[model samples]
Target: MCLRGSLHGPSRCGRNEGRDLSLDQPLLRIERLTKRFGGVLALNDVSFSVRKGDVVGLIGPNGSGKTTLFHCITGFLEPDPPSHVEVMGESIKGKGPDGIALMGIVRTFQELRVFRRLSVIENLLMSAQQYQEDKIVPRFLNTGVIRAHEARAKERARELLELLNLSSSAGKTAGSLSFGQRKLLSLASALMPDPQLILLDEPVAAVNPVLIDKIKEFILDMKCAGKTFLLIEHNMGVVLDICDRIVVLDHGERIAEGAPQVIRTDPRVIDAYFGT
Candidate 1:
């Protein structure tokens, strides 16, 4: 009844495997990804590709391995052997989170990851600093190079604050902001690194309706600027509106995939979300 594996078989997911990856390569490629927590199979040999500049939504019922797949792809959790994640055709199977970030992939959590104590501007600056300067030595030496780096980071942070409409709250403490504002801040922080592909986990969860529209608009704008995104969102309206394609999973296996309209009518997808 769970449809542990449906018509979308394990091997079929990675059908593009043998193609020439050099031409029109995907920004992110997941191959036979599997994850287990003790005896529980959280993800079962999942595979998919996110093309450059496309907004792809990952959706399913609760416990359908949506976030688990994100964790494995972003390096927060490692997959079992034979699972592979590729960025620009290079395997990142063993890379840690930081390493993956340095490779131009950044992510946000379902729960906001804002620094509560830091001011809005400071939060963005800290995120910018991670990628803009030498972390350890620069802090201690206080050389001119570090000073210039911090200045550049501050400038970039200001630009992001403006772009994200957080300029008004630049001096406010992150913890003092409303929940919706914190969500925007978390997304802005991830953008600080100017990553190539952003993996967002439940970005619109718990957000109010008005803020949801704003978030959707912002994502569309970013995509127009050529940022590729892989997002996990439960709001079917948002997913169908913003995503060019969608992947649906059930019981740790992918049950359906295609354009939003096709997926909307796919019986397999309907069964996965609504149950038999």
Candidate 2:
């Protein structure tokens, strides 16, 4: 039996009452993850795990390899040999972006990836089509089976739009929506696949306080529905409120990791952020 709400707080599946997450294996794990860009060492032996149902926060200063870590994990960049990344206990070191995503991991970029010319719903439909079905014959033939699949995809898009409170903007051009709305749309698009673990890169960046709250609400709702997340956010307040455990990186190396409370008062964290 694992203790609840200790100084380190609960582990993965932390929010569940009286449940020990220790017996369960991690959903994602990395071992000695190292990345280098020519002469610059972007990441050196960084490691962490996001267990099932865990909302883990990844925080670091600028150029701390936080985004690079995300890229490596999602197959955007290859890590050096002997560096291992695993999803559900299987190695994903050499897998490409689509392959990793199909393996149940999806990520949202800090920079929005919405289609400017596409309608809000169209963008989501595109995401669904790309991942949900990849058969060339069904796509080009547009047979009854393919049409039914598309119908289901559109239905799922509507459901996601309603969930994210964007139902009214379904027909609007994605570029015409407010910046905050675009962010929400991007998040909805990422969810079109119903991915198991969603990696958010600064989900609340540049948004108003009201919109930030909405994003937070969406995350909490999904979490309650058994979705897991690994978030990279600079907003300390949001990180503290939403994450069960926080991991801090500085200069491309993991410097600290613990519950929010532990991270708040950590000496190394203060020094890293403040340079004191």
Mind giving the per-residue lDDT tens digits that candidate 1 earns over 1-276? 011111112211222223354568889988889999999999988988998878899999999898888888878898997798899988887788888888899999887888899999999888876654247775667778677767776776776677667889999999999999999998888887778999889889999998898788667767756678899988899998888889999999988888888899999988778556
Weakest ten-residue segment in model 2 by summed lDDT: 1-10
Return model 1's CA RMSD, one decimal.
Answer: 9.4
**Model 2 lDDT at residue 89:** 89
What residue runs in model 2 are displaced by over 4 Å at the alpha carbon?
1-18, 138-142, 274-276
What's the TM-score of each model vs. the native?
Answer: 0.87, 0.91
Please provide, for model 2 over 1-276, each residue's C-alpha lDDT reduced to its tens digit, 9 standing for 90 to 100: 111111122222335424587878889999999999999999999988888777899998999999999999999998997799999989996788988999889999988999999999999999987776368776678688778878877877887788678999999999999999999999988888878899999999999999999899777767765778999999999999889889999998999998888999999999996456
Q: Model 2 reaches what TM-score against the true structure?
A: 0.91
lDDT of 2 at 165: 85
Error of 1 at 202 (Å): 1.0
Query: What local lDDT score does residue 65 receive in model 2, on the 0 to 100 scale?
Result: 94
Give the whole-model CA lDDT for all candidates, comma-separated. 0.81, 0.85
- Candidate 2 clashes: the total is 0
Q: After superposition, how far is residue 16 of candidate 2 from its true place, in Å?
A: 5.0
Candidate 2, residue 136: Cα displacement in angstroms equals 2.8
